[model samples]
Target: MEEVIVTVLSEVRCHLGEGPAYDVASDTAWWFDILERRLFEARLGKGEAQVHPLPVMASALAYVDDARQLIVAEDGLHVRRVADGHLALHVPIEADNAASRSNDARVHPSGTLWTSTMGRKAQTGAGAIYALHGGVLSRLFGNITIPNAICFSPDGGTGYFSDTHENVLHSVPLDPATGLPVGAPSALYRHHGEGGLDGAVTDAEGLIWCARWGAGCVDAYTPAGERVRTVRVPAKQTSCPVFVGADFGRMLVTSAYEDMDEAARAADPQHGRTFLLDLSARGRPEPRIKLGAI
Candidate 1:
């Protein structure tokens, strides 16, 4: 276990910060405060983050270009113009269903967008994973309680996600041509540690960097389920981790303070802040989403 020191990047007291991703075009980092209905973007070592309030509660996002973004919000996926922060509804994904909202999401190397929906109140078995391609949305799996870690392998041959409530991570074979699941998913990793698996991202070398929700660290594991390294953070409820910096040599971690009580918050005042860690491991840039309407 290598002890890595992380610096506080943002002190924005977020309730449930998640969906941290790097934008290669702008050379910046972006994430969402799901409960606060806000999105934040910042340049490394620059100034304060520029905050934009989303019309609906947004969970995850991916860059469409340097000037636009694809956001998965309470009303489904929308195209947001970055210049004026204008959001236009592009696709209605469960907009009529008030019980659920979008959660973890990412873009595939094959130009497809994948996302998950969970019950707003954390209701059991009220969520599922979905894929959006060719202007169509399809559900991949169902009966999920809390979906997280929706990421893909470096080779784009596999997809990984987890049901946090179950503390089990699963993987599925993906079709290279269509970017859809080719077969059934199998259990890849089970968290018997102090924390459950939350959001995750795959490194350039095909290692999965998972944020352990209550463990206060990010664990790097091989594709074959071998834990190799651990990087600890100051916060207890780590939400997600994104590899960034020049050539993706650094990591930015997001955490939460949503469910903590008074005593817990006092014990760790940096619970909701973002952390930046200098890393020797390099990472590949995230693929830009290819939405049909865009």
Candidate 2:
């Protein structure tokens, strides 16, 4: 593998930074500090970032259109107006359950959104994954401990997800047009390392790039589950990775300082900062989410 240069993209520290997304139309990057209930946005190459306070703990979001966004929050799915940041409840997912909050998520090539929820305390078997399409939310998996790495392949025919607590990555076959699973998921890779899988994204060539939460690195693996490349990150708790830039030539990664103590924080000064990586692999743009009743 070639040398990868990592640089800081934003200095704002997040207690539990997670989701990272890019909107091609506005050339803007967006991420969240889940524990702080805050959202951060900035243009590519822009030094300054705009912070927006959110009402609920939101972990992931998908572009519904140029004017609106669908945000997956602790309470439910919210439609956010891009102009003024006004939010309206669009749909509810476990709104009655106060124990869980939204986690990692991603959109499929067919415009369906896949998201997960987990207990606030990382309680075992307290998480589940769901798929949202045409205004309906369908539960896909349950009894998950810490669901993460929700991503899809370039053609949308395959889906990938991981249970960090289990350290196993699984792959499922899907209907490319609807983003619904056509077959059961099977184990693709099992990690026996320092950290578990956090979040991941699929490249244009169908390779899976995953962030290792406590290991301070992003790894690339072939569809056959072979590790092919690894890029070191400055932060130890790297959480998520998203492709950015006009040509999707660069990747944006998010980290967290949620579970660190003073000593750990001091040792890892860059624990909660965001980073950008220059790599040879390119990514495809995220698909627009389709909302409203079908």
**Which of the numbered candidates is closest to the native, going by highest lDDT?**
2
Displacement of the residue 50 alpha carbon in candidate 2, Å: 0.9
For model 2, the stretches where C-alpha displacement exceeds 4 angstroms are 1-3
**Candidate 1, 73: how far from true, in Å?**
0.6
Candidate 1 segments whose C-alpha is farther than 4 A from its true place: none
Pick out the ten consecutive residues of candidate 2 with the lowest summed lDDT.
1-10
**CA shift at 80, candidate 1, in angstroms?**
0.4
TM-scores, one per candidate: 0.97, 0.98
Per-candidate clashes, comma-separated: 0, 0
lDDT values of the candidates?
A: 0.88, 0.91
lDDT of 2: 0.91
In angstroms, give how far residue 53 of model 2 lies from its true place.
Answer: 0.6
